[model samples]
Target: MESSLLLIQLLNGLQLGILLFLLSAGLTLTFGIMDFVNLAHGSLYMLGAFLCASLTLYSGSFVLAVLLALPLTALAGFALEKIVVRHLYERNHLDHVLATFGLILCLDTLAHLIWGPAGIAIPLPDTLNGQVELLTGVVVPTFRLLIIGTGLLAALGLYLLVNHTRIGMLIRAGASNRTMVGALGVDISTLFSGVFALGAALAGLAGMLVAPIAEASIGMGNDIIITTFVVIIIGGIGSMKGAFLAALLIGLIDTLGRSFLDDLFKLLMSTEAAETAAPAVSAMLVYLLMAAVLAVRPQGLFPPLSR
Candidate 1:
């Protein structure tokens, strides 16, 4: 019974990690390549979830909503870059933070105005609402398995896009030296827009996938975005590979710790004491890991080769 329960928790952790990777990948990429500190990235994620939820409700089709939301999210991202983010690119990080923070406030206000103050629940599609039996007497949700697959596929697609494509080469060059890349007759502005849009799309994808599982709510972005930051920091600020691995590590640690820490503590201490300490310890695991990593390497688990 314990072993089967452990397996389920492990899969849950993997699903969470995958979602974090989806969100963190874009953040690390945008920050790494453009040096743009977008506090509003989470706002974009919230908007994506709202859009998807609304679309699914109205259209009565989750697939259609997802297909539509991706392009819409990308377009919204492009517009944001072209209008507001472009001006902040030449500014300092502090300036970037301030501007984007204001944007976040604006987005939250707009979301409340549009969607009201309540959270919306996205129903799982009929096909994905079932469970899959993995081993004898061990069952996992189909949607969670899909999430794991989606995350792996997104990681692979991102790898190919960044490494095997022309724009990707430009992204690499830009990360190393933006001025030189621009001097080589490359249109840096257009490239930045593309990168930003792509990042937004990835965040949106993460938001959409999570909506059915965890209901879409205002300020949800702010909550999860902090964890995503932890993932990127632990993984490496600008390394997608680092983000992927770090997210999985953090996710598994968090999930499993929350599940079993009290049990471990119970063996060593009184039941009441274990209960009191478990939640705090579980919450601190990621930050503790981050601090330890920084104390040793200081550059994260896998710092980008370029930056």
Candidate 2:
């Protein structure tokens, strides 16, 4: 039974990990291909949640809300790329960070103004609200399973899109040498817009999926943005494959660490010490994993070509 409980927790970790990968995959691609550091990526996620919530309330359908929000969010991304992000591309990382940080502030304020300060609760359709019994007799929420399935599908789709399409070839070329791609007469601006839009759409999809589970609120993106950054760093900047693996690893470590770290600590230390240390230690596990990875690989698990 205890082992079964552990298995359930592992599945939960995987679910969370896959969602993180969906968000991080787009983020890493935007950075890798366009060299654009967008801290406001989380804003797109927030927008998706809000849009889905509003649309679901109005349309009375989660599927329709998601469908509408995807393109809208993609447009929002394209607008940001054209209106604000384009100027920051040639600037240093610090400038990009500042500009994107400002965008975050603007977005959060706008979300608050539009959605009001209160958090919105997304209602899960009855069909997706229950629990399912797995092979080991462990019951897990159906909504979580849906999230896991959607995330995996998105990851697989992105893999094929980036590795097997002409656009994918262009993205690869841009990642390795943006200047050279432009020199070769590629319309780099169009590529940038497409990449940014795709990234935003992914973030929005993640937000919409998670909204039924987590509250949609102003400033909700802040914590998630930090988590996404950790996923990218651990996975390797600009590497979608790395992001997927690292996100899953981090998710499993975080979930399992939270579940079992206290017990493990009690075995090695006093109960008081274990209580004091467990939370902090569990929170640090992903960072520790990242540090370990960097110590060995330096650049990341899969560094994109520097030039």
Candidate 3:
């Protein structure tokens, strides 16, 4: 039973890691290249889940809702960049933080007005609603496995887009030195806008995937965005490789810590004391991990080559 529980927790961690990767992939790109601090990124995530929920109900197919919501989320991000984000780009990081926080409030209020204050639950098709046993005794949800699969495919696609394509070359160049890329006639503004939209889409994808389990509601992105920041920070601000691995590491540590920390503590101390301390320590595990990482490698585990 313990082994089975461990396997299940492992899968849970992977699912969460994949979701974080989806979010941090875009965020790291935007942060690395555009140097923009977007506190409202979670708003995009919330929007994606709500959009998927609405579309799923309207279209009667979970898959189709995802397809439809993705582009719409991207468009929303594009419009946001052109209208509001672009204006703040020239400002300092503090201004970026303040403005984006305001944007978060605005976006959350808008979501509340449109989707109502209640959380919206997403439905899955039969194929994705069942459970499967990957190991002798460990059963996992089909939807969670699908999320992991989709996130892996997305990571691969992003890898190809960033490393192999011409646009990717331009992206790297811009990240290293935007002024030089702009001087070379690369149309930096448009590139950054596209990057921002891509980030939004990735964030939205995370939301859509999570909604079936967590539901879609106003300010849904608020808490997760903090974790997302930790991911990018631990992975390195501009490093996709860092983001991917760090997210997985953090996810595993978080899940396993929350699941079994008390047991480990009980081995060391009394059961009551262990129970009292476990929850608080488990909650701090990620931050503690972050602090440890900073102490050892301030630049992160895998900083971008340019950095």
Candidate 4:
């Protein structure tokens, strides 16, 4: 039974890590390649969840709602870049941070005014509402399995796009040296816009996917965005491979810590003492890990090779 419980928690950690990957993928790209500091990325995630939930509720079809949300979020991303983000690309990081921070405040307020203060719950599709027995007696939710599959697929697709394609060549060059790419006659503005849109769409997709589990709320983005940032940092900025690995590691450490830390502590201390110290220790585990990693390798586990 303990083994089964451990396996279940591991799966849970993987699911959480996968969601972080979706969010951090875009964030790392934008910050690593474009050098843009987008503090409002979390707002995009929150907005995507709310929009997807609203559409799913109205359309009465979960599949269609997800399909619809992707493009809609992409469009929203494009519009945001064209209108506001583009202006900050050439500016310093401080300016980018301030402008995007204002954006967060505005977007959150707008969400509250539009959707009210209550959270929205998305009903699970019939196809994914059941649990699957992976072994003789161990069971897992179909939705969580879907999330794992979807995240892996996205990672594979992103790998191919970044490594095998012509545009990807340009993106790589741009990441290494933006001026050289412009000198090569590539349309830098359009490329940046596309990258920004792609990032937004990824974040949105993550939000939508997790909505059924966490519910759609105005401040949902803030809750997970910090974790996403941690994933990016631990993985190394601008390194997708690092992001993927680091996310899983952080997830496992976090989930397992929260679940088992108290029990482990009780073996060494009184139950009351263990309970009192476990929560704080577990909560700080990731940050402690991050600091340890940074102290050893300041650039992170897998910083971009180009850098």
Q: What would the TM-scores of all predictions be?
A: 0.98, 0.97, 0.98, 0.98
Compared with the true structure, all predictions reach lDDT values of: 0.91, 0.90, 0.94, 0.90
Better of 1 and 3 by TM-score: 3
RMSD of 3: 0.9
Candidate 4, 103-200: lDDT as tens digits: 99999999999999999999988899999988766799999999889888988888899899998888788899998899889999999999999999
Model 4: C-alpha RMSD to truth? 1.0
Tell me each candidate's RMSD, in Å, in order. 1.0, 1.3, 0.9, 1.0
Leading candidate by lDDT:
3
Query: How good is model 3 by TM-score?
Result: 0.98
Per-candidate clashes come to 0, 0, 0, 0
Candidate 1 yields a Cα-based lDDT of: 0.91
Better of 1 and 2 by lDDT: 1
Candidate 4 has its poorest 10 consecutive residues by lDDT at 132-141
Per-residue lDDT of candidate 2, residues 78-148 (tens digit):
99999999998989999999999999999999999999999899887899999898876799999998999
Report lDDT (Cα) of residue 29, candidate 3: 83
- Backbone clash total for model 3 is 0
Task: List candidate 3 stretches off by more than 4 Å.
Answer: none
